[model samples]
Target: MKRPSLRTGVRWKISIAIAAVGALVAVALSLVVHNSARVSMLDNSREVQLERLLFAQRMYDSTKEPKLGTKLNDPALPHDLHVKMKQGRRATYVQETASGVPDVWAAVPLSNGTVLSLHSKFADSTTIMKDLDRSLIIGSVSVVFGGCALGVLIGGQLSRRLRKAAAAAGRVAQGNTEVRVGDAVGGVVRDETDELARAVDALTDALNERIEAERRVTADIAHELRTPVTGLLTAAELLPPGRPTELVRDRAQAMRTLVEDVLEVARLDSASERAELQEIALGEFVERRVGVLNPAIKIKVVHESWVNTDPRRLERILGNLLANAAKHGGTPVEVTVEGRVVRVRDHGPGFPEALLREGPSRFRTGATDRAGHGHGLGLTIAAGQARVLGARLTFRNATPEGIEGRDGSGGAIAVLWLPEHAPTTTGSFPILKLPG
Candidate 1:
């Protein structure tokens, strides 16, 4: 099954995270620089204001009244500054004026229990300080925006490399051995993603080698046994007139069947094989398969269904599933057809936990009757043929919880879903023999 793609991809996540941190750092640095610059500007202004206050003090004694931004006990003075000056203290304060612009005030206590005050147009406050604050804010925002862009660029490059590697690995898993990392990552420097690509490449090479070796071995063995198996069957036929002859013929036929199965496996593993597909009514097709197998097996068609598939390979799959159910399961075996899907159910104890978990294997039947019969190749052949038909075959034990099996108490059900959507492949006619 294909894994669901991420909604918020890694690159965007990286971009957002970097932008968030950049925004935080930008805001913090702007606050610090703005605060320090504000304080420094105010201190310099305060020194200049104090000098003007001294000059105003000299003029106060001579003029005896306010002039040139000087005043004596001006009622407009802030109440806090007035209280401080009356208490015999020089005071300076800044407050927003009625015009919404800030002004600086200076006050001095006089010997006659009066206070003298001076005001200066809060010069340089309009231009230098306002400009500084605006510049800081703009600079901080620009840094954050630039950082976010940079993060997106870098993250996109990285994500592309990772995505390429993942896609290549997926292709390799699907048996494409030629895929490689090919030095296709961003930046000159190497990283872990590069290493992952290399690893996938190496893994593909190894898997290809192993599969080729196994296929060659299987084909060679089956080819070698073909002539001998034929000879054995021919020899048994010459003596098949009594009980011993019958047993010999049966054993020889079984051997021939085994050899044919191995050859078919080798052929199925080869890439050159292709399926011959035809359209058929699924319900009628399944009934024919059922009628040929066991008249006792029940058949149910939930809906009228038509499918394009290799009837020969599909027949092999269904035949094996039915034979397996008849051998290992209890009575009342049933075949269900719905759409392009077929299900074979048996009323005995469900499949072995090992088979249910890991699927079928050759020469390893999951169960045995009182006679200890079964070669374990039935489901294995079915699964192989199903793959050729581009179908899904799943086995599950029925339980109270759901149809997907875990408990063995409710019997076993094997579901086969044919995919006419995908191009199916098949082989020559089956060996005309039953599997395990």
Candidate 2:
């Protein structure tokens, strides 16, 4: 399974969403608290300064003196306050800085040609507000980080379960019918994910049952028809040599071939066929098969590698490929052996678009010169036999280079990849190339 990108995966999306929401809420709360606290603190400071100003006024009235407090004689007092006092204002207050500290000042003009002023420092309140701001900021950061951590932990678990289910489905698609997502670790929880896993398992089970039933029915029909087909062929052979006899013999032979092919297909579906692996020189094996089929076919040897595989299945695959090329393609068929691979090329009109796209279907022949020669089981059987031998068989239209037909058209090429080691008992065919 491929890992998803961090920027695009569900885990990151979830984490980011949670963190954003948490940060927004945290900031809003901090602003509300800070603004309210600042207003209340400033009001209290103003009231304290007012009480001090009234006290100074009372002392000046009783003693007939204007110098009532140390603040009235302080040099830091703004000149504007004294000017406002001299203009005979009842009371005056203003915010100013004294000795580099924030302070509120209030003044009352006395009849003795003097101003009584009161001052209060706000340094303690300001320090407290700063500390609160710092604490709120730290708390907001902690909340955002905690939300992200929680989101990641939950998202990781959810993604893991989904990935397991997807991987199981992939295995089923690749022909492993026994795979089931419901058999995952951490047990099954009664949730939507569990339901999905169960549904997939049920579907796989149903498909396996239906395929098995079809295989059984096919195998039975083929087995039953074999006896009658053999009898017909025997009786036709006993007939006197003539055109009629030849016709009967040919029809019977065709019937027998069809039945045999059907039976082989049934075996392949049920995996009843097994490979008998043996060590053989790859070059010699391919050459022998080609020699038996056609003497004039060209052979190219790039490497004399050896392999362990089923000789019978290998021959069957090669023979079918060669027959298919000769029937549908042009002349000068070429077989090349390099390492553990064998490629068969024919110079003729290339494979039809339908065949190349949909692959070979049983009894469905390609639209070509040899369209009515035989049933389309040659390539199908070749593919099945290659699978049984733990090899990969693929077909494609040959490239148009030095190999072109008389009509200036490309041909078809079939490639078979054989592993160096024998196929495992479990039928898993992993490609393993041996050092030359």
Candidate 3:
């Protein structure tokens, strides 16, 4: 059995309820009218019969001889009455007869030894009531069907408008940030759909303005930095090495590193530089990067799992972690990879407790720190890349008890966790399956 929908504004439900109530009331009223008519007709018939009996009594009193009144029964009354009159030689008997149907003949004894009978025919109230009931049923049915159709039409129209508004809102939420829901034609505007459309339009306009402002700022910063950086690179490359200046070489290399880091961070934000998505073995990748870094550290690959991610982006995140560990952390820093989670634990004097709480903030670290880290932008850039690849990066201190840094101080750990994609059980099928 198909169940009825519980949606509000269902015309069929309202129409059925109204028709059922109307039908019941019509039937009740029809019965009342029918009974009332029958009773009234019966009362009128009884009254006329009583009057005839009274007149017969007066006639008998005037004649003074009861024989004339008794003999009146010999011929009986007219055809209007169903009565049998029989002569008993000494008296007469007049009996009214009926067939137990609606049409009945009633006879009553008069005071003067005479009898009067009144003929009553069947009442037509039943026929009138039936006609009335049929009229009510037909009217109710017509109205119900028509009203239901109208309601369905109106409901469908409203639902369509709401669907459009929902689609527009979904786009705005997804960062399209430029979607609009136009006005609906021939529909009520006080509903949720109108409110949603207005909200979507307003939100899209606001997002567009903010995004435009951010784009202008990013572009200006990149251009200002690019000019001097380019000039420095070009001038350094043209200098005569016959002079063989160690200071010049060191400064030039530092400038190049700074420029590369800047460009890499900028590329991370550019939409056109999205990393290629591929399924990569987490254990193998972590081991390879650890081999390359080799920071006199205890590196452990704890997980044997696969993930779908951008390889280049993942490498960049790991590279920054290893560099930070080697610079700030002492020798024998620990590198651990478990599933998609990677932790670069360091055995150095941990970050200043207060500063550790606010770690990775932009420009918080000085350019000429003990480890030569600059402006604290490496972790920030790595965090940006991790976010783009849907990963998380965090910093925390190592075990407080017994564990000491290479410098005989407490140590800190930075952990990075990425999500692993589950394996597909079947190939070349629309339906999804999990690996058993």
Q: Which candidate tops lDDT? A: 2
Task: Please rank every candidate by TM-score, starting with the best.
Answer: 2, 1, 3
lDDT of 1 by residue, 1-436 (tens): 9998869877788888888998899889988987798778777776777778877787777877655677777888898897797678887887766764567888888778777788766766667767987898888888888888988888888888888777767655554456575444434768888777777677777877898899899899999999999999998888839999999999999899888888877776675556678998999999988898888888999986889888898899888888888888777898999898898988776677667767777778764431256677778778778766767788877653234433434667898888757563342222121111
As for candidate 2, its clashing pairs are 330-348
Top candidate when judged by TM-score against the true structure: 2
- Which of 2 and 3 is the better model by TM-score? 2
Q: Please give each candidate's TM-score.
A: 0.69, 0.75, 0.46
Candidate 3 yields a Cα-based lDDT of 0.59
Off by over 4 Å in 3: 1-215, 223-228, 241-244, 270-273, 351-359, 366-372, 399-409, 422-436
* Candidate with more favorable, higher lDDT: 1 or 3: 1
Residue 153, candidate 2: C-alpha displacement in angstroms: 2.8
lDDT of 3 by residue, 174-275 (tens): 434435675432254577667767776777777767866665565567567777877876777777775565566677777667656656655544433554
Candidate 2 vs 3: which has more lDDT? 2
